[model samples]
Target: MTLTLVTGGTGHLGRDIVDRLVGDGHHVRLLARSPGARPDVEWAVGDLATGVGLSDALQDVDTVINAATYSPIARRGGVRPVDFFRSPSAVDVEGTERLLSLCQRQSIRHFLHVSIVGLDDATLPYARVKLAGERLVRASALSWSVVRAMPFYYLLDKMITSFAWLPLWPMPTTSFNPVDTSDVADHIVACAFDGIFGERTEIGGPQDISIAELGGQYRDARGLHRKILPVPMSEAKARGMGFVISRGARGRLTWADWLQHRYSVTHQAA
Candidate 1:
């Protein structure tokens, strides 16, 4: 049985990954900063930003599911691009390098790094850092796999909140094929098994939709009448964010289905 250590094990995706791994009867360990205890899984108090408690976390662990992320989303509201490096990218880069060094010394069997769909060649700071981390993982002697999934549906709540006040929302026409966290966890757990693929595997939602369509779904689900007008993306934003979301292995949930089940009238029981 593979003893798996999951970084960011308390995060949105990390929780699902841990649950799935434990359900599959694997020994699961969590590497977190503090308050990492749970009912069944092992907890190692570790701060990726500072490289604390990592040795204890990795001890006797043959595999690592690195679900940790440092992106603009984690930052407080109203933070500008200039202040981004002050928070996410610097720590992201440093933490990945630290993790890689430890993995190399420990001879980890498989290292699966979770990345975004459009990050294959994205210029975005988070995407760039993830690409760098993936490169480091591949170059290392340890077996590695990079699984790229689309944005999660949870982010739509934030987007909706940002645009709720405006009668005519002016937002970038960024396209997405949002996948559910449960579906993403299922795929990642499967990839954690034997036969690791060092190459990237992409997963997205059942259908591709623009920001306007996503807004429409949220509006209709809420039973609130709202006009969602797409703002044309500037040349720079389009070229930078339109990193070409690949469609290879699509997930089962659609945006409409997810909304209906989560918030809309479709889920009478909910």
Candidate 2:
């Protein structure tokens, strides 16, 4: 059995990747700061930001799927000027350089990286750091593949839910193609088994929907009759905000479908 190490294995996307890799008969090892009690796979208590336990995690590993990232802006609900300048580089950029250096030393066969879409022309600091990580993977000698994915549905969920208390919800009119994290996980696992192609694969959901439209859908899903206020953006900012992958592989579920599934499951559990 091939040994694979997954960074950020406890995160939203990382959890799905770990489950799929284990189901596919690969010996999965997860790198986490505070490891969970998942009995099926081995856990290495590590922090990518400080290069802690990464070498141990890479030992005897054939493949590495890097899903680790740090986004302070997202956690704070809005971007602050302080965080906007430097936040993601700690994990996504410098940590990647550290991980790649160790992977090279460990003679790892393949390195698979997960990144966001629209890094090419994005002005956002997070996207810029992700682009730097991509560059590092490309420059490395190890056989590698980078999977650039669209914004996930849950992110949109959080974005909309943040304004749940407001009578008039503010939403950007910028158009984007958001995908389900499950679909992105499937694509990543497929890339892992497809051998090291040393290419970038972009994946997204089916429709190109505006943020305001998506907010309306969220309102309908939650039975909230709040009015949506479209916030206008400058042409340059809009261009940076909106991204559509015309030729990339599309995911199965739409935003509405994801909403229904997520809420239904929550209702059932409740």
Candidate 3:
């Protein structure tokens, strides 16, 4: 059995990845901040900020999948201290660095770092740190692959349901190639098990849509009759208020997202 270690194994994407790995019969070890009732998973209690239990978590593991993020979405409208970005860097970047170092020491076979598509030149601190984490993974002595994915449907689900009673869905004009979390999880698991390394793959939905259009789809999917309101604003303004408002606001559309959308729509139109 392949002993696979998963960081942030309790999160939205992380949980899905864990479930898939466990279903596939891999000996799974999960790094979580708190202990919970995941009976099948070997839980290692550790806070990424403090680096607790990381070494124990990495012990005897053959591969690692990092699916953790310290974004405001995880906090759900609470005021994150300035250290929110710094702390994630410590965990997401520096913590991954530590894990890779340990992997080298243990001769762990593979490392998979989960990153976002626009992080290469993204202005958001979170995306930038994710990019740094990707860099650390690539530069490490251990063999690795970076999976850069687009925004997940969970963001859309949360937006529609959280404000279900609202008259209108307010979103920016920013576009995205939103992907299903399940597909992203499946792809990551496949990469981990197959020892695929040395390149990053940009995974997204089969189609792309503008935030306004995405809002409309979410509303329709949930059978809610809400107007999709697109607010025209500069990127800086959208990002600033988006941090306090919609998760869609903070995301800058990557060339990949843009081109993917263009190609998909053109194909559909033809």
Better of 2 and 3 by lDDT: 2
Please provide, for model 1 over 1-270, each residue's C-alpha lDDT reduced to its tens digit, 9 standing for 90 to 100.
668999978877899899999888989989887765577888888888888898878999989998887766543323356643533654456787788889889998888888777655456666677777767767877788988887788766665756476677655576667788888988898888858578666778778777777887787787766677778765456546633455768788888888888775443311
Q: Please report the TM-score between candidate 3 and the true structure.
A: 0.77
lDDT tens readout by residue for model 3, 196-262: 6877566776654577777665555445567777976676654433221212222244424433443
How far off is residue 101 in model 3, in Å?
2.1
Instruction: Provide TM-scores for the models.
Output: 0.88, 0.92, 0.77
**Top lDDT model:** 2
Best by TM-score: 2
lDDT of each structure?
A: 0.76, 0.84, 0.70
Writing each residue's lDDT as its tens digit, candidate 2 over 104-172 gives 998999899998887788777777888899999989998899888998888778766676778898777
Which sections of candidate 2 miss by over 4 Å? 76-78, 81-83, 232-235, 265-270
Model 3 whole-model lDDT (C-alpha atoms) = 0.70
Q: Using TM-score as the measure, name the better of candidate 2 and candidate 3.
A: 2
Give candidate 2's TM-score: 0.92
